[model samples]
Target chain A: MDPVGLSGYLTVGAVLFVCGVICMATKRNAVGVLMGVELVLNGANINFVAFSRHTALGLDGQIASLFVIVLAAAEAAVALAIVLNFYNNHLTIDVDRAVELKG
Target chain B: MSVPELLNHVLHTDLPRSVQIFAPELVLCVTIIALLLVRMLKWHHKFPTSWVALFGTLAAFVGVFAQFMYMKTGGELPQMRELFEFWGLTQAGVGTAGEYFTGLLVHDPFAVFFRLGLVLFLVLVQALTILTGIPDQEDGQDFYTLMIGATIGMMLACGANNLLMLFMAVEMMSVPSYAMVGFLKGRRLSSEAALKYVVYGAGIAGVMVYGVSLLAGVLGTLSIPELGSRFELLMGDQPFSLTNPTAVATALGIMLVVVGLAFKLSLVPFHFWCPDAFEGASAEVGGFLSVASKAAAFALLVRFALAFQGSGEAIQTLCLIFGISLGVVSCLSMTLGNLAAYTQTNLKRLLAYSTIAHAGYMVMAISALMVLLSGSADPVDSAACVEGLMYYIAVYLFMNLTAFAVVAFVRNETYREDIEAYNGLSAGGPMTKLLCFCLLIAFVSLVGLPPMGGFFGKFAIFASALKAGSVHWFLWVVLAIGGLNTVFSLFYYLKVLRAVFILPSADESRTVEIPGFNGAYVALITLPILALGMSWVMGDLTATAHDVAAYLFH
Candidate 1:
């Protein structure tokens, strides 16, 4: 079988992006929100790689995908570190508890 | 040349010049490494990390100065006449000539000038950190390291010439700031602020990257300068259509990208995290975010908006759409900011709202810029718009920093942040009164009163808005809103002053005697707020701003 078309890959990416955004909006767990962030980033990554393969966008797309992966990991590390601090202070990872600074 | 030959040529020919242009960044990177090493080796015990941070920042400032001097005088030490010619730092004879790092970054006058500003700002913030004792001796190295790391990111953001560079630069700047916001470890509010900041920041960044993917895929390029011509080809003379994937994708991508930038600028509808972060974090961190992050974001926004070069009809329409929408956002941000600030009792939260309002003011200049560009005539007015932005940022740095510094100082002495807590500040005697006076000056300057720096900044922006109003009638409305918001802002800023001098403290024990050095520090920072307002001295600032605007257009 031939490889999937650009539209197919884009459809998959769009689904993932939507799921990720919805997750970010709905999740109360800090780590769950982080997972949503990763999903959104990877969704974008899939689009970048697909473009590099199927379209005239050459190495730049692949390079961008690689960067997205690295930066996603970096973001996760930082988010988790913050989560650890939150857990330490409140003994919970529930973002709802982190509202001491509200108006 | 063949592909391999082209790659080889870029590697050999471009690499050396890129390093030369990146000298200041190199200094900052070296400083970060040195700071870490000093910490691991316990050198910070003998030599303070704050000193190391300050020394590194000063060195970077000197590096920028040397480059500027070299550009101006062709590497020769200046004689008296040449010195006179270059004095007041007009950026005379400095063209837009730049060294490019392949496609990553460009070292132009705009980049250099902002880098200079960031480094100078770092020097002062480092001093403030030392004086305020935000970073105790045990953690000084970590604090300075994060601070310097963030500065490097900001400098890079100012010079990013490619989409990849832009994303990386923004992340680089933001990551350290997240750490800095939570730097006061074991504090409940600090960690909460960092969590909120990271979640929101990471989510927006992902959205931005998705937008980037769509844009780059459709356009088949990530080089910003190349996007314009490609846009002209893909969008030229095309009527609006939902059926056109290219057009829809481009529009979607642009709006998504703007969302990311707006989050950083803390414009309304995307400004939810700003006040919470400010209220949770220390005043020092708040000041850093308000000034440095906002400046870098404005720089990125200008570069992104201006990247659509040339005079194609399709491009002109796109510019107009951007202008009108930006105007609406500006109006919303200022009105919301001023109204929300009215009932706030926390000083930091109030300033955060003030920052949002000021962002609205700055974005008005962008709208003016776009409106002027849509005309494709009167490039001078557009340059004035850019100059207005640069000038506003320059003055805003001092005005906002001084306000936050005063807050940090008083918080140190009294551990209070509420307006009601500051009752009868004038009754605390001369030192306390002097601090009160400085706060008054800062608040008045923030209100854009005469004889203060903010007046000139606001004046420059409002003047450009009026200039653009000649071409587009809507900008007159933007000008009207800007003027009205300035009046609205005055009530809240002065309420702090009134609390300080007018309202009497019911508890006499609340008044604390501030030390002489802290009062002197307050005066030191406050002096520039007055100096930049003087007519004769402001000539240099306008000249510098003009030079930067000219270079950007080039």
Candidate 2:
């Protein structure tokens, strides 16, 4: 039987990270960009948890992933609140619409 | 030891001592909680939330002051002396004093000094906010809550020992600032600044966390001190070159972390949000963000940089590359910041660019420190670099707040934000004359003129950079660019003074009225800039800075 190895987990994490970066760069909606941030964080979380399986990392990686999850939640909450406030004033979620403070 | 026994041992032994050492931060946390509870109480309406916040911050300052005195005077308090002996926290030689909260934070001289500076700055900023009346009675709770919350985050950032703590501390500081920038409801520019800040901040933070994960995974630890040894081990017996896969990976991780820190520090290429944020937010909030956040970020950068030290050949090579890169960053930030400030007409936006320029000056100290470290020469040169950085922050706290306080005072009367509005400011009554006089002093000091604290600060940094250049010639270029940027910065700051004193009043009918007491407030903050400039008056701040630098290696 074929077994999934560390390289497979790493490859998946890399793909998730690339996708998240692209999402963040291309998305115009503030909320959509926030979702991209979540994806990026979760990709890192996957790598952390995967590394926890290694003997050297032991439980620290798992503990780090847990911390990442909690932080990501806090970040998302703050981002959403800012987006909601932006929408309340601008009447749109598009980040481009909020451009009063240009150089 | 069994796992349960270890847990029990930590719970009993470490927790109590950690709490004692972290009393100042705990006071801040209690302030936040108490603020919320007070808001819930009906009496909050009668007693202004500003008073509550003022008292809370003062109490925190007292705690920090007590701790600082204890450290400075060899534990004059009996309780502190006992505590230090019991926890093995006393400085036997001059490295890390102790680890607190099980190594999530360190109780070193560097951290303690920075925490003391941050709390002191917070008290001053709160006083400015109250004077400017930016947060009125009705919304004072929300405003003070966020301000205190953000300050707590910054204090933590200065002391963070673990990667997780670093990331969380930065985010905690940033989140509240984003809200504060947008707190002016219905203001279009304010909301825009908040949006820009949050989006850029979140993206940068995500990248930094990914970097942290990669570094931790490869190194098998999140503790900063562990990274140095692990790095030496990972490059064992290999030729010192960037082509090595491990070095490449580690560099990528570090550069990612640098990106996030640079954004916080508002280095160019990442400084787009800074001017806009300052322009949109009130001068008071801008003052807080500029001074508090920058000082804390500088501390974090110093800590992060020092944590990568090792005597191995490969480590030396990596540190050299890192130092050179930071030198380049310092050059770019200073040159770009000064050039950009030349075109800015809005007073707040101009000051924002000036803040970026000063950050460049501060980063020069870091570059020198790094260069000296990588060379593995005399540690005194590197120590002087840190001293210069700390002294700059100390003076900058006064210089910048004075500028912004004047701006806020003028805005209250004239509602004018552009430079042209300052025409004939000297022509106004006694209060306006006093404000103009204060502004002149602040701007002159900012230009690093002799007799102002900024001059000595810049002198210390440039001297350190020259010492570094004597070791590594690339730092010469950093020193040259710093000199050139100082000249460039002088032009624009003088431009403001010209508008205030030389030019005719743009409008004849409008008279800006300032209360007489406000003159005293302006004087109170601005006098320090003048005093710090004179070496004889302030004595040498370098002694205190040396104390901080002694703890850097650990």
Candidate 3:
């Protein structure tokens, strides 16, 4: 069998990205939404790594993915802290419950 | 290059120059650390963190001011160059403009201009917080830390030259703001706002990065300037269409990235987070997000869009489409924001919607800019489009700041931010009257009436859009809609003013009494809006903006 090519890796990344967007759209749990965001970021990361290996992107793609990883982790930490704050106040983590400041 | 050779060049050459060019941000960094260290060492009792933050921001402002002067003077001033030499920062290192930090970012007149505005804004915000006392002594360190960190991120955003740097800058600017929106820890609304802000922010950021990956992979590069050149090569002279997979992917990437920026600017469709976050956050934080973040995002937007500008039929077609789409978004943002703002009872929510509308107006300038650049229009006219944007942002900083400052002070005295809370403000004491007058000027300017800065800003942008209509007839329609929106906006602003000046006080026994300091602060910032209306001041600012805008084209 032929080795899995760039298109195969791209197909996987696209699926992950589509799934993540769907997850974000459907999920009402704040943490679930955050996890969706993570999935999307990791999907992008996979694309970056695959492109670095397969294309003329050279080291830029790999370096960008690393930065994205660090940023995603930091974002998750801040998001979780914010979620904790919400839970403390409302006694739940459902985003639908955050309707206090609606128009 | 061997490791040692690369290290030698970087250590001796790149380090000094990059550090010098990056001095203002470095100063801000040290300030952030000092703010934390003061609390860590338990010195908060004797020394106030607000003072520390103010002085640090002032220092950075001076640094940016000097850098601006240096760039404008072309590093020819003997005294200024000598001053830099005194600090061991060479003329070649500080004032000279080009890519810095291995082309990850740039040091140019445009970036310096935005940095100057942002740092000065940081100083002003610090002073306002000192007066308003939003964060008590215990939370001062953490508050200023987040605020300065965000400012630094915004500064970087103005200078981002690479796709990676662009993403990093946006994230850096956003993360701290998320924490800040929820700074009032005990408030349920504040926490809720932060929750919504983070979830939306993270989701959009993910979509944006994914777009970045696609663009980078398809183009095989991440450098912004290279993206254009690579794109031109990829397409050759072929017409750009969906049938071409490369063009399709590239267009998708660009659209997704713009969506993320649109979210930051609170344009229509992606603007759901704005009103909630502003109403949840304190008025002071609202002021920061509305003014500083908008300025930085606009700067980044211009930079990103301009990266695709070049001469070719296909490229021109793409740019024309981009410009038209931007015009559509601008139209929607303005109309939606103004219409939504009409019914808002909460002052902060009203201002948030107003922010969205103002963003729409500013984006109109950019749309004109893109269209002008796409066509073979006069370079002078293209430069004028950017000039309008720069002038608008500068005027907006003062207009919005004054408005939010009034809200903060009133909230302090009355602990209420409803329109009803401001009823009969003009009937109060002298200080309250002055505060009310300042709000009138801010609101009037926001309505783009004459004899105020917003008029000139709106005039410049509308004029540019009219000029762009010569290139494409659609911009004329955009301009007309913009003018009508300006008229539409006047009623809501007057509605608030009527409440303040015409309506009777809710309680006959109670009168709002604004402190002298807060009243003076509002008046001081409001003076600029009035002063900028004068031809002399407007001429000077326009010239400066022209100079900065010219840098991008060159």
Candidate 4:
């Protein structure tokens, strides 16, 4: 079997990104939406690492992926905390319920 | 080339210079730590955290001001050198323009200008918080910590030179802001706003980072300045076409990245979160998001868009496309923001739409800059484009802040934020009249009236756009749309003013009496808008903005 190439890795990354976007669009649960965000970030992480190995990006891509991981974690923490606050107020984590400020 | 040599050079030479250039951000970091420590040590009983935050912000502002003066004076000022030395900072890279921290960030007049504005804004916001008393003594430390943290993120955004730095800076600015939107704990609206903001922000950020990865992989570089040269090399003599796979990938990546920035700017189709966020958040947070965050995002957008500029025909074509698209987006944002604002009864929501409209005007200036730069126009036209943007941002800081500050003060007095709350405001008392007068100035300036800063800001932007239109006729349409939007915007602003000066009080017994101190605060902020409209002050500011903008082209 041939080794997985850069194109293969990018294909997987693109699929993941598409799935994440679809999930974010369809999910009504706030946490599920946040999970979609995670999937999207991880997809980018895959591309970064694959680029680091296959392209002239070298260490920069790897470093960027590392930073993205840390940032994603930070973002998730904040998102979950906000979701918790929403839950506390509305007694549910459904984003549809957060229509108090709509125009 | 060995490890020891690289380490020695970085440790001794690069580190010190970067630190000196980064003094303001470091001071803010220290202030954040101090706020946390104050809370941890339970010292809030004796000393107020707001004063601590204010002093720290003032110190940061002074540091940035010193840096601005040093750059403006060409670093030959003796007193400035003495001040740097007193702070235990070296003079290395103090007055010079270059990349610092291994080229992850830049120290230039443009960045310093934004830094000065952001830090000064931090000072003003801290003072406003103290006067308005939103985050009481119990929550002062948390509020200041989050506020300062977000500010540091914005400062980083102004200086980011690498794609990674740009992404990090944006997140740093955004995450804390989400928390700030929900700072009014137990308030359903605040929590909902925060939740919506975070979900939308996270999704957009993820998409943006994916675009960054694609661009990095395709171009084989992540440094912003290097992207253009790499693109030139990649395309060589080939014409730009959709059929080319590399061109297709590059366009997709650029569009995705722009989507993220448009979210921050609250341009059309991405502005759904803006009015909701502002209406749900407190007026103070709303003001911060509208002004400071917008300023930082604009700075980042300028840097990011200009990164693709080069002499190559393909690159120029690409930039021209970006310019036209941005012009279209600017038109849509302005028209929609104004048309939507006409029906808003909540004062904060109206300002939100106004914020979106003002953002559109600023983005139009950027569109002109991109178009002019891509064409063979003289360098001065492009510089004027940037100068227009800078002047507009400087004036906008005051206009938006005063408007939101009035909302906050009224909310404090009446516990209401509806336009009806401001009815007969001018007839109440001296203090209420002062508030009414300040709001009138803010709204009139926002409508681009003369003898106010917003007038000059709008004129500079429109003049520059006209210059760009001479290069490309599409910008002419944008300029006309901007004009119509400005005229259309006047009615909504007057609608609010009519409530203040024309309508009788709904409840005459409920007179809105602001304290003398808060009245002075409003007047203090209003003074700059009035003063900037003066010929001499506007002239000096124009020259300063011109200088800063000149450096970008070089």
Better of 2 and 3 by DockQ: 3
Consecutive 10-residue window with the lowest summed lDDT within model 3 chain B: B82-91
Candidate 4: stretches off by over 4 Å = B78-81, B88-91
Alpha-carbon error at B360 in model 4, in Å?
0.5
Q: What DockQ results for candidate 3?
A: 0.90
Q: List the residue pairs that clash in candidate 2.
A: B452-B533, B453-B533
lDDT of 1 by residue, B426-475 (tens): 88867888988888888888899988988998999999889888878999
Candidate ranking (DockQ, best to worst):
3, 4, 1, 2
Report, to 2 decimal places, the DockQ of model 4. 0.89
TM-score of every prediction relative to native: 0.95, 0.95, 0.98, 0.98
lDDT of 2 by residue, B1-554 (tens): 99999898688767776776777777888888777878888557878788888888888887776667567766656756654454344333112267778889887777878888899888988888888889887788889999999999999988889988888888889989989988886777888788888988998888888888778878878888788789899899885776888888788888888888999999987888999999989889999999999988898888888888878888877788888899998999999899999999999999999999999999999888888888896877778888889888989999999999999888888888899989988888898899999999999999998988889889999999999998799999999999999999999999999999999897877667788877789999998888887755567566777777765643
TM-score of 4: 0.98
Model 1 CAPRI quality:
high
TM-score ranking, best first: 4, 3, 2, 1
Residue-wise C-alpha lDDT for candidate 3, range B1-554, written one tens digit per residue: 99999998889888888988898899999999999899999898998988889989988887887788778886667877765554445568766788889888988889999999999888888889999999999999999999999999999999999999999999999999999999998999999999999999999999999999999999999988788778888999899888999888988999989998998999999999999999999999999999999999998998999888888777787888889999999999999999999999999999999999999999999999889878977888988899999999999999999999999999999999999998888998999999999999999999999999999999999999999999999999999999999999998899999999999988979899999999999999999898898768888888899999988887
Positional deviation of residue B434's Cα in model 1 after best superposition, in angstroms: 2.5
Q: Over the stretch B285-363, how does candidate 4's per-residue lDDT look in tens digits?
A: 9999899999999999999988888888888888888999999999999999999999999999999998889999999
Candidate 1 TM-score to native? 0.95
lDDT of 3: 0.91
